[model samples]
Target: MPADENTAAEATEARRGRGGRGERGGAAARRAARSGGGPGQQLTYVTRKLPVYEVLGEEGIALIEANADTVLEEVGIEFRGDAEALALWKEAGAEVKGERIHFPKGLCRSLLSTAPSIFTQHARNPERSVQIGGDATVFAPVYGPPFVRDLDGNRRYATVEDFRNFVKLAYMAPNIHHSGGTVCEPVDVPVNKRHLDMVYAHMRFSDKPFMGSVTAPERAEDTVAMAKILFGEDFVDQNTVIISLINANSPMVFDETMLGAAKVYARHNQATIITPFILAGAMSPVTVAGTLTQVLAEVLAGAAFTQLVRPGAPVVFGTFASSISMQSGAPTFGTPEPSLVSYGAAQLARRLGLPFRTGGSLTASKVSDAQAAYESANTLNSTMLAGTNFVLHAAGWLEGGLVSSYEKFMMDVDQLGMQQRIAEGVDLSENGQAMDAIREVGPGSHYLGCAHTQANFQTAFYRSAIADNNSYEQWSSEGEKAAHQRAGQLARQWLDTYQAPALDEAIDEALKDFVARKKDSMPDAFS
Candidate 1:
């Protein structure tokens, strides 16, 4: 029997049982039989519990909330070209003028009440699953880059092969928690049909949780359908397996295409990140406070819309705030203003009891040079401090999001290791204190040979694979390769050694057939 048929039979059995015990037992059995169950799988990297750095006090938070509400009621937001969304808003007691939606004060917040404070996002490999929201920060790779930087330092339009390789890199990297969506745009693939290939690549190349398609409503449907085939319809319905990005057309607009994709994910109870893509002084206000207010208002409207679609639907309060350099009309990243805005936005999300998403290893540097290193580190530190739950572009970001550099990807992944260790903080357990080692070593003796040091030496400290920690003489003896050189070597090494996770042969065949049929049914359409 098909999985859905078995599910229906189990439901019938539960209904006929005397108590609810049989029903609970049936549910337990179904969960145990969930796909992706296996042993000895690597666990996804997660942040240990730590205090989130808050830049905003009570007054600042209140002022931002008040300004956001003002923007909602007085300024209003546009849900352009989405009639159903406009109608839904109207029925929900909002004043709709064409595509613009004006909500009464407190309505958006009230609607957001049903959204879960934290939710579990399952992966194909059960051990790779992650808890998104709260203090737990989930790091994902760079998203939506259209160009790729090769090891030989050549930049070109990304292809389907480049896409698959990035997926493999994400799979092999222990730091990245989610496989992510649109690692890069494959210019060689048709716009309409590319989503199918992207989803297939993620399904076959990585076992980590990943985002779903949001390019069009049909593509979003395809994502759900494909997920159903892999995880079973019942499992997909019961658990949040996909976390799709639903970006808001900033300056108070939500495009029809994005809204349509969001509706599908919301209805299915899959997670969606409601991000306000703001470039301060360009897409939003010039001031950080002003930009933060707009971000809050846009996210509030989007999050509320998700709840209206399906109450208790998992939604992330997201912000993609950057600044436009006054000297040039270019967008800048890892600047002080965006960091401040991100800090406040996180507080706002916390105030509304929603998960926050923002910050990454963002940089406008063209190469993996010193500028790239500093900028990337600045953003990563901000995200870690602000307690961002889902960090898109956590690694591999380059040239103001226009390219994904392989060398930078490896270097950033290594830095993410440092962040993880810092988040773990100081362990004060009896063993961690190392009182025995101190006593054994006494005043001036070395503790390297002590029992405690010998026992815990392997895991004692973070060892950097990218950074050279050798003495000057030792460094001179060996070729003094730069960080990027070492990182490039590591990137190529990972690609050379990566092995795709094992999947059931029947399911793999089904996935391939589904892709072939879907591609055949649609003519290539480029937007």
Candidate 2:
């Protein structure tokens, strides 16, 4: 056998040997502790033990930073529609030319100094709260998909029911750490009023941390009001109970809609993830280096704006980098260049002393097929290895993010469990050493029946919930099923068995009343 395989076999054996008949009860207890005594009992997030894969050297990073500073100083960024934002920039020594704000060198960085490097987003269930920075990595489900592929393989516009279902699935998923915002856009609900239902669904169906609506400034205000209802006003005021996404219009622009929402969240002491939604060759330069410079410039300006709203607010440096097919003008995922961008961008975020968000199980495939699997894996793996702190769209993405697939969600969740294990790195404990088992088994003899093996076999390896490893004859006897088919079955089973975490009666009633009054106050506008 090759050395690496041989080493892996030995490590597996050692891990298995760490337990024995005497340790069985302790092993079970340990398992319970790790799993937080079953789902929904205690919320948990991954703290990576593996070293981050850094593709850029110090010189490369310096070059990118210098270029980004030049872009900010020379070209400047346009702040359209928000005069208040422009005024603040001018007040802070930036040269405001019409709507464009020319930031002096080191201005954004100085402004970001007050932003917290790490902060906790308090879930209604305190045990479900997550740390969002440093070594921690939190996984949130797919966000903002307008369509969904149901269990039967039919794709259709997502409704509020579909939205709630995705929230429930995220809650039940052992690997999903956050109940993501806008899991899929509920087109059935009026555009003006859907945020109410979406926020309420996350509050009602799941106890995990969730994102706030940023569609409009008033909608963001509504989200804060509702959050105050769920979590007390004082708690909401003093703590970060919500984290919202604020995307910059790529190529050096920050629209008023995003700016307004960002100000609302920042002023309320909530978190704002400033992401540059860049599609290379369209929104950004085709070269990875060029893209990195632009991403850094955009993130710096947006994140700095949050600090300007409130000095000590929490903010995340986020980027969504993907390439476009030059010939077809369609976005591409899981490519090498995007991975490089992710790695480089992560380094930049770290250098700025802020939490970073990037990467997801992204794919352009319309269905959960081999193409989807390969593309999603490429992006997902890079996301983890790049040391991403907060991950949005960690699962269920398909059709270049236009649709969320039920089967793909489950498959991605299974892969997420693997990522969790990878983040745990290697166990160097005495049990993991397995010296006693090795001594007993000696050379050539198998240790399968040994006491340690017998005791630890159940938990020694990450048993995939989706992959089928059964023999061909057994597989044929049961009806051969593709991965998507198996995943679809799992999704159905989870939804069937899902039991929502309890909420206080008063809080639930208040949330419902708030939604009703808000809806009644506004006439439904589909657009």
Candidate 3:
């Protein structure tokens, strides 16, 4: 081994030795528990035991709903560049003026009645399937970042290898339940054909439920066909195997691309998350209430369109709300205004009886520094308390969603493990009372040596994988590495140790064949 590698190994061994038997045992116990039931055994998704925090009272919620209705009835939302969508609206009793569809007072809500309040998105490995509504909180990795900050802290355009590495990282993370779509845009692949590689990475590298391509209608169709080949045609048609994102162009418009993708997913009995991408001052009103109203209005139109395509189809009411810096005209994240918007939007989704999707570890910092930590914590806390059902961008976001940092990804994964612990709430069982421990260890004596303490010590607290809790002397003696440095080391270790889940040979061959045939059918389009 190299000198540096030998030094790192020696330091790690020294730390383990100094941690004592209890800490070493705890770490071993956690590892054993994770691997006990084979893959997908470590908690599939979080079911929150704590009550959801609500910011809007009855009157406040009613006011926002009324304003959203007025926006739909008066201003109307445009279904741009898709005459088929306009025709669907017209046929469904919505008044079509050009490409804009003016809905009646209760049209969208009534149409959404057929949508399920909760549904399961089936993974190729059934054990990894996730419940995406109600008390469930499913964490997926970051999506749509064009660049990556590598282990050496250099930023560059993301490639297909980076995409697959992210998939492997997400699969290895116990708290990230879903393998996200477009973890980062692979610039090395053709824009028109990259979805094939991206989707294939998700299927081949992970067994978790994943999002689908929605960049174009045909790409969405290709996703469905590939899913059919993997899961079988009849099974794919009968169940919700793939869930995709369909973003409504903010300020009340559903562009042709999103509209077309949504229709394709809906018609095939798949799931779609109808999100309105909003920036408080630019795409929406600056005020929280105004932003909530616009978000509801946009989600209503987009989700209602899914039901129109196929009644009883699953859909998630999603919002991506941020505020922009007034001076620079750049997007800002982890701000108070967007947090308020998330809270209000959650209440709105509940009132409409739909699954809500929002919030993540969002930040605008160029690297995984103090600023990134603070911003990501703020947003993640709000996301948990606000009752977000399906959290996209739950990890690895940086530089205003432009770059995915490897160190930040591991840091966020550690935080997500903490969130999982928080969601468990307090335990009031007899064992949790600890009266026996108090009795055994009398006043003035510590419980560290008590029987109860020994029995429960291993799982008593959440241990952060990226945090260094050793003495200052010990830290300095090792290397005095910063948190990001430690996180980078851990990320490298995980990638080195990652093992792709078992996949059937026939299914794998079929998926590859489908991808090859589809790529051959179309000329590559970079734009």
Candidate 4:
């Protein structure tokens, strides 16, 4: 298509995407972007707006753009680990030596323009829907290192079993919509085998849209092979991978691993989900606006690279921004930064007419205490309200998503259910919210068994577990437990009653054989 035709198509689609549930982010964003709007209106939980960055006004956007440019120039990524990757990087105009491959700022920036902004991944249970490059919830549990201590006070790592259980939980989790499936324990499997194991678990547990981590460039083909094995020879060709994640080091730089993976995934028509995080007041300019501009720049440069690799290869804009705690000097997420950044990034994604991804139930909280509830509530509220289509770290997160908790998993789901209710967004249709029932009661009479209420009670109110649904005496009799306690109990019940999915006898045998073969063939990695 000519440049003019492409622009025309974008313009037309942008207009058409404005009013549906999928475009909730688009609607709330416009409302919040209005100048001089009241603080309440701009608050992410109340309406769709960028998470509240300390930087207000145009400066925030400026910071995002500037940082992106910095990344392109001084911090270009290079692949130095594997021969195939090195060859590809060099062919792609990346400069390299030893274990690092680099690229030109201009080339990096150019790729952002042509990347495909939308793609799809069909789920086995058609009821489970995920639109990778659209406006809808596509949540995945947190990935990366684990740092939380268990009841024994021993620090737990992300082992293969841990990865499998997490994937299993993700399968059972009602709100956790995506899987960073290869979530690994640093030592459980060697880098190469880990991807295969992760993919194997995913193919067995679910036929959902998932992704491969670009933690290392050398492992890219292994991840791709997993896709091939699961979906057959045309996996990449069928666009079954949907989207692949590419993480850009914040402050400034695209590491070799992430960049090369982006190229490989894009070659297959998979969307590249690239997120550049700025530890505000740390890796980023302290000012909120300045940080945003930098963050945006980081993402845009990568988006451009994705476009260059294969114009219109599916890509979803990702924003992972957090602030530094002045007292601790450590980065803090699950705070206002995650939401604020999500909001701003969604705005930018809208500006570009692409799907947006953001964090959820985010926090820097440790235990599942009040702090956990507070942080989780705030982040999830912001993401759903902002209409983020791809919500990451949505459940099974504890200790800022570094640890998985069966307990916290259910808690997050409960919280998400509440948010979904809110997003169901005031059913004020003439007969929707049951306004007629309220009017019939007319300011004082009890509507306990009113005809209208009898007909529509279920639709009229927000229900809850520890949400105070009883008289003082009734409550006293049950022992007033806090919301978290109720949530905790619910988690236990699910685990106790949960039936592990039964695999086909032949399929199960195949899986066992595969693991056994991997263990035998690569003792160091699998054993």
lDDT of all predictions: 0.85, 0.89, 0.88, 0.59
Better of 1 and 4 by lDDT: 1
Local lDDT at 335 for model 1: 87
- lDDT measured at residue 387 in model 3 versus the true structure, 0 to 100: 93
* lDDT score, candidate 2: 0.89
TM-score of each: 0.92, 0.93, 0.93, 0.76
Q: Please write out the lDDT profile of model 2 over residues 34-125, one tens digit for every residue.
A: 43322333337999999999999999999999999999999999999999999999999999999999999999999999999998887776
Better of 2 and 4 by lDDT: 2
Model 4, 165-206: lDDT tens digits are 667656555545565544435455676567666766766665
- lDDT of candidate 1 over 1-527, digit per residue (tens): 23553454345322222111111234433322221111112335566667888998999999999999999999899998888899889999999988889999999999999999998887776557788887788989999999999889999999999899888888877677889989989999999899999999998888788999999998999999998877878777877889999999998999999999999999998999999998899899899889989999999999999998999999999999999988898998878999999999999999999988999999999999999988988888999999889999999999999998899988887787778778888899999888988888999889889899888765577666678888988877877888899889988887886767777667778889999999999899877
Q: How many residue pairs clash in each candidate?
A: 0, 0, 0, 40
- Tens digits of lDDT, candidate 3, 1-527: 23542343344332222111111244565653432211233566989999999999999999999999999999999999998899889999999999989999999999999999998787776657788899999999999999999999899999999999999989877788999899999999999899999999988888788889999999999999988876767667867889999998999999999999999999999999999999889999989999999999999999999999999999999999999999988999888999999999999999999999999999999999999999999999999999999999999999999998889998998888888888989999989998999888998999889999888766677767778899999999989999999999988987887777767677778889988988899898889
- By TM-score, the candidates rank as 3, 2, 1, 4
Off by more than 4 A, model 2: 1-43
Best by lDDT: 2
Model 3 TM-score, 2 decimals:
0.93
